[model samples]
Target: MFSRLIRAALLAATPLSVSAAPVPANDAQRGLAALQAMDARVAAVGERLAVRGAPLCGDRQMRSGLLVHGLAQYAPAARADAAALFGLGDAPAVLAVVPGSGADRAGLQAGDAIIAVEGDDVATATAPQGAARFDAVQRVEDRIEAGLADGALSLTIRRDGRERAVRVTGDEGCASRFQMIPATRLNASAGPYVSVTSAIVEFVASDDELALVLAHELSHNILKHGARLDRQGTSRGLLRAFGKNPGRIRATEDEADRMALYLMARAGYDIAVAPAFWDRFGRRTGFGMFSDRTHSGRRDRMALAVREIALIRAQQARGEAPTPDFAGR
Candidate 1:
């Protein structure tokens, strides 16, 4: 909801394996960690969907802004196998890219090793890839973000041993960014950025459900719901220590719910999963429809999603693209 992932490649110096009997508890933790890393692919799906859908729905009300290279998750690799897959000879490799995004338009193909940025060797910008690939990825991301302010960035892509310098433009969307936090809590929230818990990532049944959740938080970003609430003077004192204003929170939830489904529709995700997720989410949390002050009941949210999805389908049937109704929201 807030930002993204950089699925980079890594070269395992040697395969780490152990006997099955009497394994250490840390082994389970390590297994879970690896699963979490791979499972996070869902975040990229949400990003690509949002990149495509949100702008289409909101022309001026929202903006056709926020250009992205659409690359997600990257890592440094040295092995010939890694080099072959990433299309680089021991360089930074991309994991995924959003279709039709600024990066896509610039021909910044996924898996192309970004060997350099603006003539500066990208490898020099990143941290030493000692034991973990993430360390290297972090350095590259920092270098990449530093270049974002330049409005346009030159990336050196290596494919089949040939290098090409591609320049990509940048655009602004909502002020919100994205982050995936480490927690098992099956929920997401947004303000300056969309924050999705690791728990939510593990809990979702499919990419469709995950995208719906992401779109909901991304919707909060697009609508500027958080800033608007703060502007309304929803107390920042003990009220914050307690909980948010129920009325204000509920209103924002309504808007987020509506806009999220349309985003899913435009992104080509199955909106049918939206309501199902809420039904499962509410039941697991023991939160009732009309019972929570900050959110509508599960039944209410799901029903609304259903209605809007149908409306979206009808619009498409009529050969008209549905736009987010931001009149009051």
Candidate 2:
């Protein structure tokens, strides 16, 4: 759990893709708009999984299906343009509201500026100089998480040049946050949060494929793989690819693969998409120096997914829930 937490923290602080490369003012505006569109797509799918996967998670939290961005999340060069483009202030503002979510039902809309959470002032939130801009927005997210824990939330928001109080009573969801890291890398990670890169978001052919990736990461969190590895004396550093660590890491990876299918099926995603997607990802992008050692090979992963899909099909044929067997897992 400690390792997972650290990984997520560091990843969130990493510079976003828009900030990774320099562009002209107009180009920056387009980039920010493109990033928000991607964020909205990811938020929609994530909201669905949060509600549907609640049964698989032992821990639960209120899910509002709200995604926010602030002026601070942009690079210094892009901040001014971003502020004008999005009408953002120092406070966190809504970037997207998934349709049918509690936030949407409560009349929350994109561009609403968050002022306070349950009467606690957050309008002056600021990130430290020379630090990741997300740090400031993350503080607001932390407060919102705490407020939602009480089963409901009251927010003061600025919209249409006016301020109003909004009450949000969200649905209970799996205790995990899904985030999109605006980077070009085709990678994803799981811990307290499940995050995917913007590149992977665009790489996926369909939401079904995207669900396969997110579900795999979310499965790692649900299964407590990080804590389990930490207990087994596994190293999270370079040494992780050496000694018994490679096998240990591969084992968790394999387990996450199996669990991911069931997670998707439970969320009403077609399990049939798993095999092909894994095979493509493995053959095309799964080979890295350490990745080769810490993960199952393409053929092995595909075979496992095929078998799991069969089991899921059998259960569905019998009118039973498609639950993954956790016998030795």
Please name the candidate that would achieve the greatest TM-score relative to the true structure. Answer: 2
Candidate 1 regions with alpha-carbon error over 4 angstroms: 1-40, 56-116, 120-152, 156-179, 236-244, 287-292, 326-329
Q: Give candidate 2's error at residue 187 in angstroms.
A: 0.6
Write the residue-wise lDDT of candidate 1 on 1-329 in tens digits. 22333323321111111221112145433443343343335435555555556464332222111211111222223332333332333355544343444565676544466778667786443333443235455565555555655567677877657888887775433334444555545667765446677678778898788778878887876777768878987653335323557678778888888888777777788888878888888788774333546778889878988888888888889987666665544
TM values, all candidates: 0.64, 0.89
For the record, the alpha-carbon RMSD of candidate 2 to the native fold, in angstroms, is 5.0
Candidate 2 residue-wise lDDT, 55-77, digit = tens: 87777889887766676666666
Return the clash pairs for model 2, or none: none
